[model samples]
Target: MSINWDDLKVALAIVRHGTLSAAARALGTTQPTVSRRLDALERSLQAKLFDREAGGLRPTALVLALVGGLEQMDAGAFSIQRQVAARDTGLSGEILVTSLDWLGDDVIAPMLARFGAAHPGVQIELINGTRVFNLARGEADLAFRFGSFEQENLIERRVGEVAYALYASTEYLQQHGTPDVGDGFEGHRLVYLDRAAGEVPHEAWLPALARHARIVLRSNGLRAHMAAVRDGVAMAVLPCLLADREPRLRRVALPHPAPVRWVRVGFHSDMRDTPRIRALVDHVVGEFELLGACLNPKQ
Candidate 1:
């Protein structure tokens, strides 16, 4: 009897996540489908594979016995898939990339346009959001991100650094006369990211600025914050790559410079040799190299 790999994948997901709904979510299907597949797989094998428990489904001895072998099979299958992709010298396939919303419009869009022009056959799906797409779950093929890399067993490279600085409209700077370091922002109207946005690590520089400055507005995105600054509503801390070119904005010379964070590109290590992924990674590295000075002006 031949075992179906797709059914085995469903079984593996159930074992990994411990519930039909969770398995269905992981596999991008419905709970009823997972249940039907599990039932069918058990009937084909003529054995009970799991015991429904209060906590969740517990794998029976039969399923436990199959886990190790199935995991190895899964890894082998992934390796083979990667090998096939690597062998495709024609470099034709869809590549999904995850990027922050702020970079989606100006920075990554232009670079991706250039990459798309060269690889006319390859399609790209760019997911731009505040949420981090899960690479381990096959959510995205490539990512352009800020700060540090956390996921293990992925190929990660620091492309550049993004420097954050306080900026105000030239009209506001002229009217407010650019608050001095000694004055400590007492008279300044500051626009900043909302603390409730749960961006504490990224906003570590803001507390000090907020202590003395009057927080006039709070926004969840850089674009909104920058717009507030441009409208003469308040001064804002913004990424230099985006704010520097805005002729209406001027950088404030503070006693201490703004914080700079590293920007990184990462993908699953297994896909390192995959032709399209490697080409995109190399293109991203080259794009960063060309604009490294602008991204990390201080360095």
Candidate 2:
């Protein structure tokens, strides 16, 4: 039986996610499309690939057996594709950089703007979210994230350190007395980072310090947290690089050292020699250098 690779891919996505809606998100397609492709895939193989249940879709034994081979094929295809593209020495091409939403706003976006202005021929796209890009599989041309990259065949570069501290607007401090770490921030209004923001290393630190403070609001975006603080609603842990320069924001005194996270930028080594990759890395690093110690505030 001849199996179309595209249809097999859809089936594999369904297997991975266990639901047509989830598979659609993974494949960047519609739910109907995922259902249709799954149907076509199963029809071509002449077997029941999945059993739909109340919980989700469960792959049949036959389809389960094909899962491993399908993943290998997917990886091999992307590897070959990027390897071939790596041969291009041209400076003018498209590049995708992935970063966390706040980091993108504070640093990555500005760096991209500088790089794009300098190299007008290069097209750039920045995806900001909590999801880390898989560089080896051509998921992103470059990735800026917190911590080190353990992925093989990748070169990691230190971007900068992100220092976070409690901040509140002058108006907020006027309305509600300044919180004291000695009091464990009791009676303070806190704007918390949303739980869905995902694995933040410094996340626990804030609540640890504000053990008694009431959470007035929760936001997934750091920008929203900063805005709320600026509006005199509540205080929140914000990046020093962003909040420090704002005249309206005041850094709250804390007995404990602020949370600091190191940001790293990396790309697949296969694109090491690619002109665009080299240029981008150099441009971003250089731009970050201008920020200097502001990125890493005092303890």
- Best of the candidates, lDDT: 2
lDDT of 2 by residue, 44-119 (tens): 8789999989998988999999889999999888889888878775788889899887788767898898789888
lDDT over C-alpha atoms for residue 122 of model 2: 90
Candidate 2 collision pairs? none
Candidate 2 structure, TM-score to reference:
0.83
For all predictions, the C-alpha RMSD in Å is: 3.4, 3.1
TM-score of each: 0.80, 0.83
lDDT of 1 by residue, 1-299 (tens): 76778899999999999999999998899999999999989988888999988888999988998899999987777656655554656677888888898876678878887998999988888888887876755668788887566876678887666677778899998888787656567688887677787765446776665577888888888889988988988998888888889999888876665678777888887778778888877787788778766665551
> What is the TM-score (0 to 1) of candidate 1?
0.80
Q: List candidate 1 segments past 4 Å from native.
A: 50-66, 88-92, 130-138, 150-152, 194-203, 216-219, 273-275, 296-299
